[model samples]
Target: MVNELSSTLSFPILIGDIGGTNARFALLTDAFAERREFPVVQTADFPSIDAAIQETVLDKTSVQPRTAILAIAGPIQGDEIPLTNAGWVIRPKTLIGDLGFESVLVINDFEAQALAVASLSAEDREQIGPGAIRPAASRVVLGPGTGLGVAGLLHAQHTWFPVPGEGGHVDMGPRTERDYQIWPYIERLDGRVSGEQLLCGRGIMHIYNAVCAADRKEATLETPADVTSAALAGKDPQAVETVSLFATYLGRLAGDMALLFMARGGVFLAGGISVKILPALKRPEFRIAFEDKAPHSALLATIPTFVVTHPMAALAGLAAFARAPQHFGVATEGRFWRS
Candidate 1:
């Protein structure tokens, strides 16, 4: 149950989407006003999260945010939340004290992204296939960035609930000849390949290397950007093949996740990488792979897929939580104001 005070957000609530590389901030004051996007901050530029926020938020606005919600990368457990891909450790109490906020919320990045699905407008997202969102049904968000992130959202009891987990770490192995060929390359790097092994930034590099080895070509690409740029421009055949397989594998995994949650509501292709490779994702291979699952192929095909184009989607999700805590499966205990 929400206390009378917790039932509504304090004015000018602060929402942040903190990632491994960049930290995005937004301010939600007027419910009717469009959410303002603050300048993106480099995570490496600041020594701590608090310092970054202090410089980017408090110092600029000159107003202490009474309520704050943070969507961070990694699991949300205990007092100190360690970022999976970053060196930052978020301590809610420290932030509350330092920022002088009455409440603070820290949630897994994907969980927040999942919640954003409800808040996203038509312009905020781009549909990848032919289908419409099933009203009030389960929805899931998955993305390939520095790491793969996954989460689901369901509506029950008149509230949108976020289901967060480490689904990205699940084992992913060879399913096709191309995948089998890539396995040996991945094995050489991380002994055991997880779903993120071939779907993430470094994964692109890995796939590029595997393609080169399989075809006896030079593994000239050094970074994920290099591979993506080459593939997009058709500058390198191996790079192009790497991206194709990446999309194919990502589609299959997305379909599996859809079955897991029965996410008829929709599946959002979030994260920076998806936006960068929008053209590639639009290819038929992606939709084909997503709908290739037998016994449920038709069902999966009916479930729509989209790439989240809005940069501040997580911030919007946080804002939604602040407006109505009951709308999410979030619990308020101590410094944990939102899940």
Candidate 2:
């Protein structure tokens, strides 16, 4: 039975999944079983998350959500969160004080995503490795998009521990002569090579340029969408090679993360680019590169790999965050709900 508070507070919850490119807001109608419930409003149409929330609440429904949780693509410390990729800086206290939300929670975008992973279903997950999840093991989550986001989930004391890391900035490895050749190309731009340099949308373009440069072909770097479309249409050889290499690098990174986190639960590939390259990622070369780790190749192969197909994974995560006991339990002090 739903508690009186849970039932009484059920107008809806305002939740946000803010990233560098967009800020997605949603109304979580059902607090329980959030894995399959909620409706999201596209953030691109709105200037800011606050505006989106206002418009959504005003235009969509009259029910006022007492709680708000914002998962941002930047660090959340104290009252200020300036977006890493956008021009918005938010203060949670201001939202609670001005917006009149009963409570507001702000966390790292990947951290919110990690929380949602615990509630993800088999149908929601697209496996990357061959190993069956051990039912009760740690899982790591990573996505390649505007930038790379990394986090891990460890089951502890009946709740999932969200351990966020700046793993995307970690230096990547070069397994092939071609990879070694391209490494320097990226190094020329950034003093050091990070995984984000070679695995995101612009990363795909970078890879294409390096490949064309290596082949001594004059190349024009195109936008990610153009390149992906060309590769999908089989009209551009350089685009094809660039996309393939991007997939390979992603696999290698996933493999390394699986080993580091002992992610026996699975390796989830979530992001705009992964969804765009789903057809190519299903190819043998991508799978081969993911399992190419020597000595521990078998181990890498055993970890299940998946592409997150849900467009609302982050929104679902926000709903989950609102209900998680560790987050909302024992609200006290000047916390919005308590007021």
Candidate 3:
């Protein structure tokens, strides 16, 4: 009877999608077709991911999962990775031993997010411009939010594989006289400027300052939300120019990414800013800059672009990762993998 009851009780697994500021939790209840099911809890309510899982499982029901998967913000190299913006240092083996789980998988947050793009259906995506999608070609996923995130995916043997990278740290170059002027202006504040410098939330303010400096106006540092508010109200010229320049740079970077990967499958723009400033992205200058890649401009025009509307798409990728056996290849003694 005990064996039958154990078989009947599904693997109430634990899954999480963590970022700089928050860690989201979900419960995968069933063993069969479990990834399709959605069970989530906000990270703000709990102090840590482990605490969140423990409290959630206890409050919901008595189901102990033998396996857990957590996707966190940072590169996965060795056993420990300090979260980009948080103080916690995640050690895979330590957590696994502490939790008494048979298996625990940790992956790059952006890689986990990339895994979901191909898995997402038509309903989850929205068109940003006119371009064709070549499903067999390489696809690029770049987002500007808490930080600039980049990842690439290749489709092979009817399966999608994610390639994690630190493309955000790539140097930012100027393509025009205006961009040239802005580039040097930003250089004054930063000795070595990366795309993340002007592509993230703080990046909006940097662009705004650059525009202000170019116009020989006094610059005032402000938060991303404040600048967006002022721009939406049409009350601040600096904020207005900031958004315009930001969109243009976004287009340029997207084009560059497309060129780098020959991303014929598609180029997706994600992050909190894209969704918040959807109206601004519709401007002519934005699309024009996106397609203005000099000789390769023609190729850029043919590549499809989009903004993922679903807030929980990354979590969906976490679910997909949990379902894929290849994601967790060989188990090791300490924490690192050999294959």
* Each model's lDDT: 0.83, 0.72, 0.72
Weakest 10 consecutive residues of candidate 3 by summed lDDT = 330-339
Give the candidate order by descending TM-score: 1, 2, 3
In model 1, what is the error at residue 168, expressed in angstroms? 1.3
Q: In model 1, what is the error at residue 262, expressed in angstroms?
A: 0.5
How many clashing pairs does model 1 include? 1
Misplaced by over 4 Å in model 1 are 1-5, 30-34, 187-190, 333-339
User: Runs in model 2 with CA error above 4 Å?
Assistant: 1-11, 29-47, 187-190, 324-339
Candidates 1 and 3 compared by lDDT, better number: 1
User: What is the C-alpha lDDT profile of model 3 across 1-339, one tens digit per residue?
Assistant: 222323332355567677776666666766455543235555456566666656665456555666666777777667776777565677667666666555566767777678777677777777777898897788888888877888888777666777778887788778788888777678432578788888888889888888888888887646888887788778889888788888888888888888888899998877678888777787766678889988988888899888877788787876765555344221223332211
Give residue 308's error in model 2 in angstroms: 1.1
What is the alpha-carbon lDDT for the whole of candidate 1? 0.83
- Write one digit per residue (lDDT tens) for candidate 2, span 1-339: 113334434335777788877667777655564432234545556676667667666456665667776777876655666876676777766676666776675667887778778777777767653668876688888888888888887875565677776788788767788878766665333576688888776677778888888777877756888888888778888888888888888888888888898898887888788888888888877778878889889887788888887777877665765665454222222222322
| Tens-place lDDT digits, model 1, residues 89-163 | 898888877778776767788888988887779899999997789878999999898889999888887777788
lDDT of 3: 0.72
Clashing pairs in 1: 160-327
Best by TM-score: 1
Q: In model 2, which range of ten residues has the least summed lDDT? A: 329-338
